[model samples]
Target: MPSKNGTKDSMLEVFVYAAQDYGYSIDITLNVHGSLVTGKIVGEQEYFQRLSENFKDDSSETAEKIKDELLKASEDAKKSDNNNVEFIHLKNAQVYVGDTQPTPSENHFLWRGKIDDVNGFFLGRIKQKN
Candidate 1:
């Protein structure tokens, strides 16, 4: 599933990195409303840890807090003054296989093509990683 803000087929590219404990670093581009939003997942391990703590204690409050934090993170990723780039951090991601079915386990590790949000559509040069 794309981020709350991504539009269909608007996503152009993505990058991902392994984060700790069922988490990952994800980047995506999509058109949200009318703007292009580029975002990256940050500090995924920390986010999952918080969620783990909450689940361990069965703390509804903590879960709610986690949700709020995720939304904030998404918003933070979408924030851009120039209206071109956005960044997002996603944790505890539920990855799927080939758009067929949800992966067997939420904790199962995989690199995901995801969209956490979108703004407008823009084409920009991507520098190759050295």
Candidate 2:
């Protein structure tokens, strides 16, 4: 018998493919705190740059849009089944430009707070390690 969480897994796979198609690689980290599950997805800078150049938009805007789509995919997966198992919620979605070093660059973008909030937080040229 298939696991009840199959639907969620399938949905996540779809998101991963979609992200890859958009020239982004998604790294997901899952953390469980009590009854809540938090998932964080980070898209590397190369992908962000490619997406921005392809879409002819600001890198910040492009990153935000990507994060939004990821959050929506996660939410949809959460609601995919009515089972009582824990569902993952997006805790942080971000796009980083340049290598994951402790050096500041003009290409770090992030979206925090609730997933429903369409606004993205731009941490201008901040040092990010991984």
Candidate 3:
């Protein structure tokens, strides 16, 4: 089912949360508000874990605070249900603003966005050029 305003696809929610419990992932391309975002759907635990690591090298207080928040959210999400889950997380995600593909960056990053914002989606990832 496609996502609607303020509501996410229930099937997608189950898939994402399952990834949290198990370590399986599926490549997906989401039509998000007229934009295409391609990546592997990841669990909240993995999402927060990666985000926390990204800030580990920074010793700034703000970074620490962010890390703390991520930790809290991670723990909270572990107990989340499909009805309560708010966001979708992706790994190695790349964004295409319109019909044309943008220049692919060498770096891939973790991305998190509101699940309700996704209008449609498909079951494959875009292959990047070398």
Candidate 4:
């Protein structure tokens, strides 16, 4: 989903903070899929390793929470018309948040879901009077 009223930036900040906590970096990419807005978040190998370690102790509850948070942010962006202009004709789009350190080089996705009503996620800012 795109960001509206700086919400996208805010969400990125959250991801950056979380990634830093685990000593990893986050890579985000936005793409246009027909009239839909698609997004991908890639967390590197070290991050995945740490996440796996945590999952062993907590059954991936933390990872689930993070995924939920990201999904929620996407949903919120959709609701607020904060998506990219190319998505103007689409009602929703899919987002993938994954780790690159998949075993056997497959099954790398940590979270995958749809964000609805993405057409509204890219409202432009209005100029203010001085």
Query: Which number leads on lDDT?
Result: 3
lDDT of 3 by residue, 9-103 (tens): 87777666667767679999888898888999898878998889888889999999999999887888777654466788999999888656543
**Candidate 3 Cα outliers beyond 4 Å, as residue runs:** 1-6, 79-83, 99-104
Q: Say which prediction, candidate 1 or candidate 4, comes out ahead on TM-score.
A: 1
Instruction: List the candidate 2 regions with Cα displacement exceeding 4 Å.
Output: 1-59, 82-130
Among these predictions, the greatest TM-score belongs to 3
- For model 4, name the residue pairs that clash: 81-120, 81-121, 81-122, 82-120, 82-121, 82-122, 83-121, 83-122, 91-117
Cα error, candidate 2, residue 11 (Å) = 19
Stretch of 10 with least lDDT, candidate 2? 30-39
1-130: candidate 4 lDDT, tens digit per residue: 3346543344543443343233333333333243322323322322333334434445467777765555554445434422232111111123433422222232233432132222233322112122
User: How does each model score on TM-score?
Assistant: 0.24, 0.22, 0.81, 0.21
The lDDT for every candidate, in the order shown, is: 0.38, 0.35, 0.80, 0.34
Error of 3 at 5 (Å): 11
- Candidate 4, after superposition: displacement of residue 32 in Å? 19
In candidate 3, what residue range of length 10 has the lowest lDDT sum? 1-10
Q: The CA-based lDDT of model 2 is what?
A: 0.35
What clash count does candidate 2 reach? 0
